[model samples]
Target chain A: MKKILNDPAAVVAQSLLGLAAAHPDLLRVTTDPAVVSRADGPRPGKVAVVSGGGSGHEPLHGGFVGPGMLDAACPGAVFTSPTPDQIQAAVSRVDGGAGVLLLVKNYTGDVLNFETAAELLAADGVDVRTVLIDDDVAVRDSLYTAGRRGVGATVLVEKVVGAAAEAGADLATCERVARAAVAGARSMGIALTAPTVPHVGEPSFTLADDEMEVGIGIHGEPGRRRERLTDADGVVAALLEPVLADLPFAAGDEVLLFTNSMGGTPLLELYLAHGIAEQSLVDKGITVTRRLVGPYVTSLEMQGMSLTLLRLDDELTRLWDAPVRTAALRWGA
Target chain B: MKKILNDPAAVVAQSLLGLAAAHPDLLRVTTDPAVVSRADGPRPGKVAVVSGGGSGHEPLHGGFVGPGMLDAACPGAVFTSPTPDQIQAAVSRVDGGAGVLLLVKNYTGDVLNFETAAELLAADGVDVRTVLIDDDVAVRDSLYTAGRRGVGATVLVEKVVGAAAEAGADLATCERVARAAVAGARSMGIALTAPTVPHVGEPSFTLADDEMEVGIGIHGEPGRRRERLTDADGVVAALLEPVLADLPFAAGDEVLLFTNSMGGTPLLELYLAHGIAEQSLVDKGITVTRRLVGPYVTSLEMQGMSLTLLRLDDELTRLWDAPVRTAALRWGA
Candidate 1:
């Protein structure tokens, strides 16, 4: 695998070290269980928010840690789940008098581990709650997930709920807002090429030159089906139709449209996809109130894109627009 | 060939349209001559800074057009320079009567077209000056360039010089500061896979699975040489050694370290590269006072990374930290 890594076994640890060195003003890395926390975390009487998953989808959980977003993020090795010990350490590091909330994606391993960590933290006298995100419409069942896989909406959930926490919401209030955000979001993805895990040193799947995987999972799992490659508009339509239908957004409804690259896709193409998506939504009488287009949540060097639609209320819009300073996503800070 | 484009011939125009739609709060796109200018432009008595080149480098010229950065950017077709009419139109739109400054990368097409536009603007009673950036250490000369090709350092020059202009520097002072920044910066890159231009329908070049091109140019041009692929640390050393030796950075020198992906590489890998780069610099006794890491400047979806070091003085450091707001780069705002 033509990747920029020292050793296959050390990719996750080395990358975390590099992240800490690069963003000294924003993040601090702890060695023992490997958690990245805000440089000045543990704000007294403020609800702390933490989330994490596999390491390859960067700027997701780790890059989201800051004053206004995540209090801490515990990253696992590439395409792997973080251990319960690591999650507990992150919770302990950022717990304030208010409490701590866990944003867990719907992967089976992630759900189990975060739940175990919550139990451990509760035993240690720290109040904790969990909100699960299962927004992906790609697969109802997969090797790694149960009902549905969480995908792009994890970023949105973190941003909105994190802002609510920063606004001095109580633990119960934070959990309610997190669940609301999760319920309002849906995502679907397509892949033109498969990404290679470092240790495997080969692509997870193979496709013909003119074939593509529609509704693919983040970890390169089988999607809805394979199809002949199409142009930008066609591919965008296939992805957006399902997401829009799943959310069942109606006329006069407003949304926050996010077109995300699954890594390896250039910004130029992402913008093109965004344009098509906006037009498609308008045709269905949906008004796009806010737009974010880039590689915010990505698979490792996977040349594809995902479309996310978050049915927005006034509160969610305001929370999203709130000041946030992070390594990847930043605005109004 | 495998890109998300509607029509090969209309990629640039369509992408520009999408950009204008996505960022109406920050930018406005002018048709007929095709220039992206600040939503509120021609700030009276302030020197207007402008830059542009090929369109494949997203967020370089177009995304950089906002407060404390380029006043306007004129994009050409993919890997092609904008015509003199387009440049003249952009200068006319943002020329506030103080003067206009052009930041041209040292490609023959860009230099020639920008020079022509300068003469046209001077004839129209608008003072215009040009600062050419040639910091790439890859080639002494090439088919499209007389000197070294301008690579990642163009972003640094635009940022520093744009800040200088915003701080009320006159045209001459802005020009001088830009030249100084360009002189202090040096960059080198390596490519594992080549990016295909939309119209070309094939990669600009090809590389075997076990081979990599070192010191490669942004447009898939030949670099110093090709060799067997190595680990991330070894590749980082190969890139950093030449850049450090070329600049001959001193023991007590303080510099800004920038690790940029050539579009396709993921943030995980870029950070991994950044970690090794920082260590290598420290080993040579150079102090990294600041860091900017991302795919700010890119070559479509080329799979590689480039390292840029800008020797920093107190003034440059302060300017680098100045408040700037753009789609791609933002800090202290």
Candidate 2:
């Protein structure tokens, strides 16, 4: 595969080094047990937020670590869950006296490892809670996940819960806010091209020039089905139809619309997708109160985009509007 | 080509509509003339900054139109310069009585059109000055450019000059600061793949699986030469070496190191490149005091990255740290 990397095996370590170099004022990276923490972390009386998964979906766990977002992030290798030791190390480093909240995406390896970390941390008398995000409507079950695979909504969970934690919420309140975000949100994505894992050096799946995957997962896994390529509007309809129906959002309900690129899609296309997605939601009587359009959570050079809708309540809206300063997803800071 | 678009002919207009919809709080788009202006613009007594070019390099001219940046932006068709009338219309709309500063990239069409617009606005009794950015150290001359092709440094120009404008610099002062930025900055890029123009329906160029182009332009134009694909470090070395030597940056000098994605390169790779580029600079005894990484300027999904180094004085450094809130670049705001 054509990738800008030093060694396939060193992708995670090297990229983290780069990330640390790029944002030294914002992040601090620790080796041995790899974890990225806020430069001035361990806020004396605030609940610490930690999140992680595979490394490919950048700007997710690591990029989201900062003042009003994740306090620490433990990134594993591409598409592989971080080990329990790594997660525990991250949690320990960022856990202020208040408590610690772990945002775990609903993947088997991630769930197992984060749970193990939580148990290990609890043994040390640290208050720890885990919030699972499974907002992808594309899958009912998968080879690597049960229920649904977490996708774009992980960003929403992190943002809202991070805000709550920053606002002096206790562990229970932060956990509740995170759960609310997951409950109110749904996401779906499609792939025009598959991404290659660096170590594998080949695409996990293949698609013809005239075909696209309708409900592709983030890790280049097979989606719900393959279909002939269509226009932006048609693709938006297919993805949003399932998401809107699943959420059963009613007229006049306010929501935050997030259009995310899967990696290789340009902002030009993502903005076009945002326009189409916004119109589709408006036609359904939903009011898009806030809109975020970019490559937030992405695969490795995968040409695709995902639509996420988070039905907003007053409290959720307030939390969503809070100041956040991270490598990615910064506003009002 | 697989792209998220409607009719290729409508790409620019539709995408601008999406951009307007997504950032109505920050931007406003006017059709016919097709100008994107700040939602609260024409700040009286402050020099207005206006920029424009071809459409494909997003978040450059358009996304950079907001508070503390461009007061207006005019976008042409993909990879095609906007007409003179469009530029004039934007200039007229944002001339807040303190005169207007036009930041033009050094492309043949862009320079011609922006110059024509400057004359038109001048004849209309509005004071106007133009600053040209030609920092690309790629080709000394090319098919579409005379001196050097303006590449990634246009973003730096807009940002530094925009900050100066927001700080109440007069038209002449803004022009001077912009010219200084252009003089002190140099950039070079390499492409792993070419981008396809939407209407063209084919890549502007092609490369073998083991080949890559070095010192490439943003429009997929040929670079310095084609060479065997290499690791990220080798590529970074090839790019930074030329840029550093061209600027002849000296030891003890502080610089803003910018590593930009041509388009399709992921944040993972960009951060890796940033690390490599920063080390190369430090090795030369130059101190990198600031960094701006990511796809600030891009070709439409081209797989490449560029390195830009802006020699910073105290004024440029202070202006760089100034609060500016644009759609793409935001910090300390």
TM-score of each: 0.99, 0.99
Q: Candidate 2: DockQ?
A: 0.80
Fraction of native A-B contacts kept, per candidate: 0.63, 0.69
The C-alpha local distance difference test score for the whole of candidate 1 amounts to 0.90
Model 2 stretches with alpha carbons more than 4 Å out: none
CA shift at B170, candidate 1, in angstroms? 1.7
Instruction: Tell me how large the interface RMSD of candidate 2 is.
Output: 0.9
Question: True-contact fraction for model 1?
Answer: 0.63
Q: Give lDDT tens digits, candidate 2, residues B76-162.
A: 999999999999889878789999998988999999999888888888898998888999998988999999989898988998899
Among residues 3 or more apart in sequence or in different chains, the pairs in candidate 1 whose N, CA or C atoms overlap within 3 Å are none
DockQ of each: 0.75, 0.80
Q: Write the per-residue lDDT of candidate 1 for residues A269-313, one digit (tens) a residue.
A: 888888888888889899988888888888999999999999999
